[model samples]
Target: MQINREQLFRASCLSLLVTSLSFGIRAGILNKLGVDFQLDKAQLGSITATAFWGFPLAVVFGGFIVDVIGMKRLLVLAFLFHLAGILLTIFAQGFWTLYISTLLVGLANGTVEAACNPLVTSLYTDNKTTKLNHFHLWFPGGIVIGTLIVLLFNKIGLGWQVQVGVMLIPTLIYGYLFSRLDFPVTERVASGVSTGDMYKAILNPLFIFMFICMFGTAITELFTGQWIDVLLKNVTDNALLILTLDTGVMVIGRGFAKPVLKKISPQALLLISAILGAIGIYLLGTLTGNAVFFAAIIFGMGVCFFWPTMLGFVNTNMPETGALGLNLMGGAGMFAVSIYTMFMGSYYDRVVAEAHGNGAFAGQQILHTTLIIPCVLVVAFIGLNIYMKGRAKKSAAAVQV
Candidate 1:
């Protein structure tokens, strides 16, 4: 079979585009779904959070079997899942229907990550982190596309279901692209890293440390991005505008990642991301309209490097952990976001009621609560940077001997 890296990479990006399209459109339509079904914020959160929950489930499981079943099959499953989930969501009548549909979409999203992450690493072994960052640019890029589509559809009076159906376009394209391409083996198989070694590597203390940090990174990025509209409703009617602008910032940042990463280690970038994320979230909690855009940029720059950097760190530093390690890192993050999103919803309900329906206060309070995740990440990543630096030095010294 012939390999065309460009075609394969394009297929991966389109797959991710579908994934983010779901997120962007779904985030835009949460209020409508809630209003139509007459559900409370907590119930809305539950329905939406299923996507997060299902993401981890599929990614982790896909990680385990990707070597056996291959990236091609995982992606085929992704296309099917996306098809079922999106169509179901368009026709969903109520909570249970929406929940089941979203779970399917979430599983598809995770499967894309499961297949694409390892596939990218295999294709760009020389610069895994830089290339991964470039590939993940599509996540925010897709969001920007989806957001614009929604804004356009709303202007024309198209319903939420139509916005969701937009996902079908990219889904079919990527599925067909994958069907035509020849997939290389996962990096793990290609490198001859034994299955036993991969298992042992995941249990390493450093791998576990970074794995746990994924929870904080995921929540800081995904949770906050997912809830932007509600969180900033009192601050601005332009919340989606901020989402578009900041995610635009993310798209640009990832597009030019190679130059920045050349000057710093992935772990150092992670440390910087945590710091900026904390500052940005804090400002977001305290600021108002238009001013939120400034904070959004800082927040964008902070989180821009997070998802890919975390996976890149795993890919470059712990190659022995293989697809399992990468998938686990992603899954751990989604799991945290899923649980916290539900908690944030309930917290919003409680605080808003206490304040006699002051939603801005409730939103600010939730931002403050979520702040702890990134704050902890700052300290943890600092430690991670130091530890990784020392390890690199030790390896360099050994090589010189």
Candidate 2:
């Protein structure tokens, strides 16, 4: 089979676009679901958490099997799951039904990442980091698209179900693209790297450290991204607009990562991002009115490159771990969001009840609590940056010898 790398990359971007659209639309409609179903923050949180839970499970499992069964098959399964999930969501009656449908959607989302991350890396070997940043541009780009769709639906006085159903359009388009495409062998298998070596690569201290840091990074980005509407509900009626603006900055930042990488090393970039992210999250907790938008811009820049940069770092620095390694890194991030989503929901419930349904108070309390995640990331990234610099110096010294 002939390979057209550009076609495959575009198809991968489309798949990610669908995934982010579903995610963004779901975030936009959480309040509507609460009103329709008479559910509390915790219950709604459970529904959101199901999506995150399903993501890690499918991603990790798909990572293990993607090489054996191939990327194309996993993507086919993802499309089917997405179709079923969206249909089920449109007709969902209560919590259990919504939970099941969202779980399926989350599985589909994870499958796309599990397959496409490795696929993109394989296609652009010389410029893995920059190309990955380019590919991930769709994540935020899709969020912006989904946000606009929701706003349009609101303007027309349409319901949330219709907004979700609109995702089916892109879902079908990507399925068609994948049907005609071919995938390359995973780098690990192509290099004849043994399964034992892959396992050993994950056990390396540096990889272990980075995997732990991913948990914090994921929580900092996704937990906040997923719940921004709820967290800022009182501050602005246009929370989805704020969400769109936040991701809009991400789209622009990631689009320029290629040139930026030439000036700043990836490790230095991570360190700088962690510091800014910590500050941005803290400012978000304290800000109000129009000032929140400025804080969101800071937060967006902080998280814009975290996910792909981390994945690119692992892929570049620990190539021996291959697809499985990338899968684990991606899975770890989703799993963190899964746990934190529920925690944030429960926190909101408790705080709101204590304040007697004071939306502003509840929102601020949750933001303050979430701040700890990014603060921890600051310390972790500092250590990682120092370790990487020392490693680079040692390698250079060895070459001179």
Tell me each candidate's TM-score.
Answer: 0.99, 0.99
Model 1 lowest lDDT segment of ten: 237-246
Question: What is the alpha-carbon lDDT for the whole of candidate 1?
Answer: 0.92
lDDT of 1 by residue, 1-401 (tens): 89899999989999999999888888888887888899899998998899999999999999999999999999999999999999999999999999999999999999999999999999999989999999999999998988888888988999998899988888999999999899999989999999999999999998899889999999999999989988898889988878888799899999989999999888899999999999999988989978999999999999999999999988788899989999999999999999999988899999999999999999899999889889999999989878888888999999999
Q: Model 2 over residues 57-83: C-alpha lDDT tens digits?
A: 999999899889999999999999999
Cα lDDT of all candidates, in order? 0.92, 0.90
For each of the candidates, give the backbone clash count. Answer: 0, 0
Question: What is the C-alpha local distance difference test score of candidate 2?
Answer: 0.90
What's the CA RMSD for each of the models?
0.9, 0.9
Q: Show pairs that collide, candidate 1.
A: none
Pairs with backbone N, CA or C atoms under 3 Å apart (clashes), candidate 2: none
Q: Give the distance in Å from residue 193's predicted Cα in candidate 1 to where it truly belongs.
A: 1.0
Residue 268 miss distance in model 2 (angstroms): 1.0
How far residue 26's Cα lies from its native spot in candidate 1, in Å, is 0.7
List runs of model 2 lying over 4 Å from the truth.
none
Off by over 4 Å in 1: none
